[model samples]
Target: MIKHRLFWPTASLLALLLGNFIANPGFFAIELRDGHLYGSLIDILRNGAPLILIALGMTLVIATGGIDLSVGSVAAISAAIACLQISKLGDQNSISGMLGAMGIALALSLVLGAWNGLLVAVFGIQPIVATLILMVSGRGLAQLITEGQIITINSDPYKAIGAGFVVALPLAILIALTVFVLISLVVRKSALGLLLESVGGNPEASRLAGVQSRRLIWLTYLLCGLFAGLAGLMLSSNVSSADGNALGLWMELDAILAVVIGGTMLTGGRFSFGGTLIGALLIQTLTTTVYRLGIPPETTLLFKAVVVMAVCLAQSPAFRRKVLGRRKPKPPAQASQTQTKVEIPA
Candidate 1:
């Protein structure tokens, strides 16, 4: 279990939960309220849904040896696009209208992803530079879509996507988990996962081995945009508004951190779905612990950094070996001197 890819991430999450439980005795307490489960644990899942969704996409992008800095912007644009369309609806609560709005947001987000893929996969631009271009540009586009203002709405169906409950579980949590499972199935059950690892490990080798590296990279980016769009919808719906400026600010960074903490190498290659899941939960748990323990909001980043670094070090093989130094073996000459001569052997 200790050697499992998800072991450290899971342990970190468990530790955070334990700390929270220690800090607040009621942290683990859960009660059914209005047909839905309510508790700090539930809250973490619900709130972290967006991050989980975003991180899943980041996983795919990173597995292709690419980074998507524009995810935050894509998320913002998606939320803005949805809210703007919904705001113009004759009845904001219309489920069909909300669905249509969501579709629009997703479609545009995919297009944005394609744009990044075009620059990187087709035009041969660096992934970082390609995605960065859309990072700022997409933010501005979102602002333009929302007319530089927050778009607030009152749509029960739309809100439910982010805040509703189903079978005693938060809808957002279910959505995140369902996406995770579905993505895992698609990637693992098919050849896509292997291809991604191959391309990420060595694009030149993969290409030489007949892999369509360009298409794969582009496809991953497109999928990343789609996932980021879904997260945007959840975030906007959760608050019932879209603040173009604040909708997904720095979300890319958080997703990246979550992916990294999950044991996925930033340099790319093999990825861990389970690790990402555990890592996202751990992050949300830590955030909850901070506020529950009455830590000041101003120091949240610093606090998170400390805990994340500690967890990271704990999971690092080199760091662990350094901390738990092995017993040194005697030199060959000393061993020979320590041994008794076998005169009968001659």
Candidate 2:
């Protein structure tokens, strides 16, 4: 079943790469210059890292049959908070106060995550509605943090978090991998993954089995918020500016797309973290291919929509059964004749 589930996306990705390579022979060239990886492939990995991080959290949240519509706003809010702190340190003191700024930004992100959890778990609010409140207000809060102004800073340490590379690989990819492994350990190796699946598959049954469904739901959202926070920091670090209005706009959709394309159902129940990573890479590669082909940027969204539809259809049970049913065998004419003869003799 797992093999069946993974086949389509894997095949599609391979085909995409093959097509790109055929079109542009230079697509696969990886050049290491001055201790930094420079190549079209590296660029995709770097740009896709933030979405991968967000999708990791989204996978957990979706596994429990819940959706988080507020992640984009959370990212914006996190960026605003981190950049505001850096701005306060001013250009001269930014380097001297790096630790303090990071600590405070992390704390604020946790608090935001906790708030989302409380609303959904304790208050018995629907995940969509509960997160919607934040989706709308979080950006306003972020704007308030920056007083509706874009705070730009020239901090070396902050830049390293996003744009810097270690051993010719992007730092963002490293961070994404770390988060992925950590979450995979907790969910797959620990009881959390099973518990989440139970809740998603049948909440009442999970509750009857003594699983703390509410608490799990809350924790999932909280973790998702934490990831969004990290993603926000990475994004802002890349630009060295916090533009709350634009930092993570529409990113929630992208994260959700990655989760769905990775074979995690939007209706939620089962999820695949590794699959989510592949999905993120696939989306990034498609975007890069589009640009390399000289297609208009506006058309990329349409292409994404098409790919998403294709994936969803391919994953659907009805579609699979329909496609497979056509391959079923038909009885041979000789076998039918023999059966008729036997029936007549009897």
- The clash numbers for all candidates, in the given order, read 0, 0
lDDT of 2 by residue, 70-104 (tens): 88888998888888888777562466576577667
Those runs of model 1 whose alpha carbons end farther than 4 Å from true positions after fitting are 327-346
lDDT: worst 10-residue window of model 1: 327-336
CA lDDT of each prediction against the hidden true structure: 0.91, 0.85
Candidate 2 structure, TM-score to reference: 0.90
> Can you give the lDDT of residue 166 in candidate 1?
92
Q: Cα lDDT for residue 285, model 2?
A: 82
Q: Find the candidate with the highest lDDT and give its number.
A: 1
Cα RMSDs, all models:
4.2, 5.0
Q: Which run of 10 residues does model 2 get worst, by summed lDDT?
A: 335-344
The residue-by-residue lDDT of candidate 1 on 228-337, one tens digit each, is 99999999999999998988899898889899999899888999888888888888888788888888889989999999999889888878777889445566664445
Look at candidate 1 and give me any clashing residue pairs.
none
